[model samples]
Target chain A: MTDSPPREPRRLTRGEWLVIAAPAAWIALFFLAPFALIVKISLSRPAQARPPYEPVFDLASGVAGLLEKISQLGFDAYRGLAEDTLYLDSYLSSLTTAGIATLVALVAAYPFALAIARAPQKWRPILIGFAVAPFWTSFLIRVYAWIALLKDEGIINHALMSLGVIDAPLPMFATRGAVIVGIVYSYLPFMLLPLYAAIEGQDPSLREAAADLGASPRQVFLRVTLPLSKRGIVAGVLLVFIPAVGEFVIPDLLGGSDTLMIGRSLWNDFFANRDWPAASAAAVALLALLLVPILLYERAQTREGRR
Target chain B: MSARVLRNATLALGFAFLYGPIAILTAMSFNASRLVTVWGGFSTKWYSALVHDERMLQAATISLSAAALSALIATFNGLLAALALARFGAFRGRSLFAGSLYAPLVLPEVVFGLGLLLVFVALDVERGFVTLVLAHAAFTMCFATVMIHAALKDCDPTLEEAAADLGATPLRAFILVTLPLIAPSVVSAYLLAFTLSLDDFVIASFTTGPGATTLPMRIYSQVRLGVSPEVNAISTLLLGFVALILTASALLTRGRAKGGGAG
Candidate 1:
């Protein structure tokens, strides 16, 4: 009912500039500064006197630390990744686990996601909230809860015993299979949300029209629902799987200490070994490992959205 | 033998699997058994003991402070970034900036956490609450941006434009018109970031000093050594607190919707 405020026609004011600049500069200085530091440290060789000291920062500490030749800044760390059995094995294992988990999550979440989308409108929000309720708690607690459940003498075994399913307490706790189960549980919500979103967005009329044309329910789901939900499927898979690949918590907490995950190995390199350059190199490789799926799925999302 | 019944049973079982552990943990907190997970009889000893636990209280304080500070800063910055990206078209290198915003989400916690540690060590920066806040803010801010951007996407921009044409200044139009529309989303984003910062253990472990141990760090250290009924009590309390807030927010939003105030 009331008229709007008069236009001030303000330019970029000093106060506004200060407010924006401070955060931007702070993010650049610290948030991004570490990334830059790691890059510079990666190029330098690990030396005897002061460890992997960069000549740029030290100025007068050691000239031998300085490698004027760009050639010397070779892929020693990356080469280390290939020849070093530990990095090679860990990277492969992490990738394999993540891939399998993503496939399993997609298969499992697909029907549930469908059921969620097809539920009555009145019940949709409640169901959706239930799906996301687990995320409200401290994620550490959920993963830790699995520790108690999956342990040798834990409730799962105890219950199985009481039911006479097996005579012995199984060694399910620290196996790679348990690790996969934990990964799936931790990340299943991520898969469900996006898949639900995409499925919900799809035109119900398409299915109705197909039904009127004598398409079977299975045929309608396969043709009308599945292909149309590709964006969500891809989005959900990448959301769950990519992070699971580089996951430190699940693999560490639920996984066997001997699981040899790339994340744990990198943690050991930095904290236990205290080799900054080598650790940075390993991280650089990990970043490379992550970029493939990230960029691919991101591009896919953009392209699919345009359609 | 019956596929329909089988699928329905599996659905129910999945729900049980999802919630059963939490229910068990909550019950075990009250169990008289000293050995965690073994039930003997019900007692409130662990809850009573947690009240007098000095270290846990300090850790809880640190965690609350970090979550509050980090969530506040991230919400402000994230709201601004969301407005900028949603309001303005592509800039010289807009995609690069957006990519930078999300890079934290994909980076392994160990990598990001330890990488931050190395940077701090190299610079001779002390490990303290300041560093911890910065680390949590960096990661939680990404989540904040995504949450707010989602709300902004559904908003009608024509209202803002109309206000601007009717003589409202750009900032004033945003404050008076656009802000009202997205305020609930902002609150949700704030809560989401707060929970994320509260839940952080991997990043906090690397960034925090000896005196700045948050709740998650304390729990992790304890769990590594051994499980305690005290931890079960703590977990129950933490879970209940978050669940309560989320429920209240949902109810408030639904009430507003029923009142015909929200679209």
Candidate 2:
């Protein structure tokens, strides 16, 4: 461990204070405070007025006014969330879609990652760069690219028809399947990079030993390589799954109107419906759903950091 | 040999999958026909149309300025946070600070977007360019911090200690010794934040006011209506811009590596 040696406690200098205080204050004001507002607004009643929520807390109104406002807060938005089948179905569908996308990305990424990892060291960085290059491009464009390929009379259909693969253009665009492809395509690098790192870090000698001990190639992989890369798999899955669950661009651009996703729902509720409270409620619920995976990811990161 | 062939084939297929859509999009941008899939001879009419678009030009201006400003802010804040996390071993509220920094990376943009919009409403801050910059910097700073922090972790601490023992002030040592060493990473972090801001759509949607629409927002609205060759043209240009930046940075790093090797 490169932990700092013990020393007499010393006060931070002005420069040190500046270094710590600026980002902390910025995060507190922007990141932490906004979540607090979300919680407060989620508990507030929707109203037909400017800002669109009732019981607005006013600092000028004193403690008594603040207490009165607090008393007016309730779980009405959350209750609406519970009662609305749209929200429920959207949540479940989002989870299912994201879950499937993560699995597909994993299966697809593992071999590509392994191939890169097993390649000559000189080639690994170039291969990894190619894998990650697409990520640097505009995400919205990447999702939109699927539209060009998947639409009726699009490139895929045109090619398929010409090749006599199908008699007609398939109904590929504006479907849940398209949304899954978009998510998998957009986030494959997230899965690939972590898996590559883990696979590349494994000891070649351990694999040789497994093979020398009469283990078949499959057995060596199942017992040694697969188990060794478990951390990477978990990290990759969480990274892809959590973000995919809240994906808006992919579902919005690629999915049919019937496709229910929490992100799209939240957008409609806030923007189109002008239901701020409901949107906040949905955001809170989405966060709550994601907390487990996020925590797992953090734990994985900390353990890796320790190593 | 068969395994090698299989591995090579898998890699080839993977890269093809990754690049194929982008390649098609770029090709479509050059097609003269209004129809996307049809080949009516190659032309740059879409690019000219994209350039002539008033809304697109305005949105591009907004996107570029916002990305530049936000990238500056994110890089500054992120560098400070990286120093705090990497140098200041333990401190009050360190865990909370760290958590907030990392949270934005994984937290759904919808959550942050809605949250920030609500806070802006509560505070009566107008939703416009400044708000967009603030919101962008807030999230992209997390990415900036992660990149810079990794670079910092890889740095040898003894050099800083040596500087301190040589009677240089901490700030001076950082500026003269540490800053030069981490300059490449800092530049990369800045570029990363810039591109992230440029690429943003959902967060910009929530946080931006009318007349402050970004290029992505413009492209998205157009895309939702249906695919257009003009949108393809703009996307290809954006891809070219990003590719240029990437190539430049790669060369910069390679140059630095060669210089260091010689030294």
Candidate 3:
């Protein structure tokens, strides 16, 4: 391979150094260091002490004490996570639930994105604004809003009964279905924005040419439009799905006691069970499970950036 | 055409799905009845109740303070990071710096929250207003950086170079020339960070200690206990505040664009 000519490396000035170093150091301390702690803590034992975990790094006790503490750390949490069906079940269900919700949001958001993208130029901004308006509101409150709408005595039930659609109120709240609804509703904007951007960026002439070439509307859509918007679909799906997989709010509020998600399980393990090691282990596993989607999203992002 | 009808129908249904609950919740905030569902008559009693609710009020104060502090810190740091990424031209460890900066955006809140809490514990730092501000700033800085970076990327670099040619230092060139041009985006980024901090629940829940509960934390607890009209009232107020800020921001950016174009 022919190598490119070597160039002189430009030294960073003081202003450049300040700008680059500040955020890097902050993230290194607060973001990267914490992950290391999580991995370390996950290997330790749960305790009845204030911090609620054993094998603390006591700097004052010197090197011997630190090594002793390190030796005491074990895979007990991961072992427990593997042994317990609850952990595995929660992980599986969280993935499935988030997956289903992503599909539902995609199906619902695609048409919305299409409508906005194809709307009159004057109306495009307004339509897009409306799509994202819900995001300005508090997420917890939005999930809470669903509680008022889905509960037995809530608006949906009252309306159904008033219209004589049903004799008794339907059970909606605290169901897996409600959790799905909450996720889809909350994440619709995430799905819509990317899809709209993708669809809107397309050359309309291509679709017109495809139609002129004897392609049916459906055929043009499936072959041209959908394929063209594949990047958006992947971006949107991962954008919604990754967060939904580890979602703590919707499941805790909208899901029944029977509803199992890794997020809620981690919350319960840490807060309710006071098992720091277990929660850390669960978090580690959740991060591991989500690695593929996160990487895919990064790839899509880089591809988009390159364009 | 049937396709047009289908498209419009989907738009309507999608918007309804998105806004219906919010509308209903806002309406219920004015319900006279104590029961959230049954509307006895039009009233602002719940709003009044929210005003007097000590716990909710205290939480709101803390939330606002933390949001302001965190947004300030995040915006400043994000401004630096944006400059680094956009103007520094592939500095050493740039990819690693960018990775950590963006990583928090997709990292599960539960995971980040747990990690931060553990760190605070390990370091023996008290978890309260300070920790909450630190954690919120850490996560929200990425978003601010993204917004400001987009603005910086679109900026013409010659103006800054011109300032430098006029004998201004690089920092002075940035402050005098580049900063004003991107001021709108900086304000927008600040507002975005503010709202994200205010809206955070899970991370705040983990990082906050006694007496540092946020509005979302309070609302979450109350909602878990069951629905209340007071919660509705508070939520409606928050919704109105956020909408107002967002509208002002939109106008600010739009006004700047128009002014720039006219000039």
Worst 10 residues of 1 chain B by lDDT: B88-97
Docking class of 1: acceptable
TM-score of each: 0.89, 0.96, 0.96
Query: lDDT for each of the candidates?
Result: 0.78, 0.90, 0.89
lDDT of 1 by residue, B1-263 (tens): 36456545655665676688788788888888976546779999999999999999999999999999999989998887777557554433345556666677777787778667767767777999988997788779878888787678767889999998999987898899888877877888888889889989988988889989999988987877655788889999999988887887677556545544445
Q: What DockQ number belongs to candidate 3?
A: 0.62
Candidates, ranked, TM-score: 2, 3, 1
Clashes of 1: 0
**Candidate 2, residues A1-307: lDDT per residue as tens digits?**
1223255335566778978888989998899998999988899888999889885577899999999888877799999999999999999999999999999999999999999998889999889988998898899999999998999988889999999999989999989999999999999999999999999999999999999999998999999999999988999999999999999889999999999999999999999999998999999999999999998888777777757
Off by over 4 Å in 1: A1-23, A45-76, A303-307, B1-11, B252-263
Interface RMSDs of the predictions, in order, are: 7.1, 2.9, 3.3
Where does candidate 1 chain A have its weakest 10-residue lDDT segment?
A1-10
Every model's DockQ: 0.36, 0.63, 0.62
> Per-model TM-score of chain A alone?
0.85, 0.94, 0.93
Residue pairs in collision within model 3:
none
Off by over 4 Å in 3: A1-11, A56-70, B259-263
List the candidates ranked by lDDT, beginning with the highest.
2, 3, 1
Query: Which candidate wins on DockQ?
Result: 2
